[model samples]
Target: MQGFEWHVPADQLHWKRLQKALPSLRDIGVDRMWIPPGCKGMDASGIGYDVYDLWDLGEFHQKGSRATRWGPKEHLSEMMQTAQDVGIGICWDTILNHKAGADRTETFQATKVNPEDRNAAISPPENISGWVRFDFSGRKGKYSSMKYHHQHFNGVDWNETRKETAIYKIAGARKDWAKDVSDEHGNYDYLMFANLDHTNPEVRADIFKWSEWIGTELPISGMRIDAAKHYSAAFQRDFVNHLRRTTFVGNHDTQPGQSLETIIIPFFKPIAYGLILLRSQGQPCVFYGDLYGLRGGPASLSRPACSGKLPILMQARKLYAYGEQRDYFDKRHCIGFVRYGTVHYSWGLACVISNTVATYKRMYVGVKHMGEEWTDILDWCIETVIIDHRGYGIFPVAAKSISVWVNDKAKGRKSLARPFDTDIYDL
Candidate 1:
């Protein structure tokens, strides 16, 4: 699950907050947390995307502060350690396409390219001053001795000499925009700030070295590559290959007793969420903003907390969404499915979703579950569903809602029983 939202308050000491929330997150069946970028950005308030120093993860006294927007280095380390202790793996959000907040400016020959079509040059090659040099004085070459110069980058947006903002492709040997990148805006190799030239051997080596350093420094299980479309796909592939061959980071080798395959449903509303979560197929991911609500955005754009219903669905997914699956996709406005419990779980669930008005669906639970009493676990319908001798029952769902029907006598049903539910166990 995504651990943080885009609008999370910067002053909340979010690392510590996440550390405290690890236990509860695990309880809701989150095995991994995709965290935001931790590296120091251009400034203390700048999000990690505005990359200044990759090595300074809120550690060195750089970018006008000793700590990143999240928290200090110690807090991030502690949070990562806590997540590991609680059996939750951390997926770091990595930014590698561009670098921002350069230490100094340098004059270099560059050709002005049309913003709409980057391949089409608008002006002849001329000397233009741009912030393409990074000395990283605060780090003092602690983790890496390599200093970024104009040759390491492909292009920049602002030309300080002209005091104008436009796409200026750096002019040099093999300095053309990367070929394997998004076709949008003619060539999307140069996204923003100083775009890293993956073709440069020195740049690739330094990036590889940093990747290895971060892998050893932190307990990262995987990475979510940012701005992938703007960078060379071959470079990204090589980077992953390098990680797999060198360290345990990004190593996804399945171990004994591990489930082989599952899909990830990143974001969904109530009806779509129910359709995905209550099924026996993919692993549904609950969005962080959906659970805890959102802040720091326009007041009209903020979202209210959906913790009330989400946790219930998560618990249902954990306890009963398992075993043989059967889909009922007969109706247009309504659809349903049933999961025949595995031998180990022994109690399955039936889910019905209606996009329009209130509806009912007749589905089969299992022959073994014949004549069992069933009711909606979501408490959406007040009626009961009795499995006929053939193990078929008609489940009802409210208008534009979902209903998960489980055997009334199923074990562990009492654990998820609502406070107002007196007949859940008695029946």
Candidate 2:
């Protein structure tokens, strides 16, 4: 597991070290690995959001070094190949909404906009704009010559002359804010640093061009789009459609109760994982924090502490829990689904999870599974359930517990065969 501000080596070096673990990760049924941002951040120590140069990915002697925090270009390539060899796909974290660490600043005319209501300009356009501009003298326009001017951005947070951090919209622009963005702050087009103007034809074209270049250059399976709500959703859709690869959505780590940690704590992680990994819907992403139980650090928020039960859960998902899915979301305080196996797959499972204490549900999976016995692979509940002749059965779970019952005849038995048992009654 990698912390947001963990003491990691350069990107290349980190990848080199990570390559050794690919086989182990693959053995655990981790099909995809969503790594951090590939491109160089504003600084080598950055997490790759404050993008200084899009073209410079730890190659040139920029940001006071020749490599990003992950490592150099060569190491990254080797890491990708190593993981791919083990059948693990790499998803690049793409940050296209904003950029920081500009080489210089430019002065222009702009208007101050309300932070809560970005659509309403507080003051008229005046010659009082000062924001970072990118010329990339260190890169010397190697792979791309797309220099960033103030006009390329919709708004910026900081003003150099006044030394104040306020939302200022660029002058001479037709629209005060980008269209069709999340209504969080009235208009969430501008997040931080220089917000990329997606409406600008050149800006849009340049980003697409960079995407194409990076996609061809690196052996990646897809991208993890950052700050999607801050940009045009249509543009994001177009970019993702063009890539024709897997794409996922997420953002920077936030405080607890506002993140997946809400359901990833010691009490409910198994239930949360069961709901995601066992289902036949969106591709489930296993966070490193959850996999290894990384906790709160000085820079990062407190991650949910967990027992080392993720591997067993992952194993269950791999060997069994395949085929068609049937949702049973009509129950109160409990929701579950059944994975019906096909001719080639027969270890289908029924996953039942509940947030309420001491819950039971009499649900129907299918008529075909009548008279079959099921065992809880979680080992938390020692009881077993049998499908009735009517294809309906009552499943019981202790307070705030998850039950993943697999067919007893199935070959998958790692979780079931484990020596330890968590008595739900004790919990």
**Top candidate when judged by TM-score against the true structure:** 1
Best by lDDT: 1
Clashing pairs for predicted structure model 2, backbone only: 10-69, 10-70, 10-71, 11-69, 11-70, 11-71, 12-70, 12-71, 357-399, 358-399
lDDT of 1: 0.81
Which sections of candidate 1 miss by over 4 Å? 248-268, 280-283, 298-307, 417-427
Error of 2 at 292 (Å): 1.5
User: Residues 346-369, candidate 1, lDDT per residue (tens digit)?
Assistant: 799999988789989989887788
Tens-digit lDDT track of model 2 for 1-427: 2222232334346665567666766665778787888687787877687887778777888878888887788888888888778888887878999888888889988889989988888988876646558888888888888888987887888788888888998887474576789988888888988888888887888888888888778877767788888898888888877666433222226324334323334677677777777788776767665554333343332332335566667777787768888888897888878788778887677777888877777777677879988777776678888999998878777778888787677785744455322211121
Question: Could you tell me how far off, in angstroms, the CA of residue 24 lies in candidate 2 after the best superposition?
Answer: 2.7
RMSD of each: 7.4, 5.6
lDDT of every predicted structure (CA atoms): 0.81, 0.73
Error in Å for residue 357 of model 1: 0.4
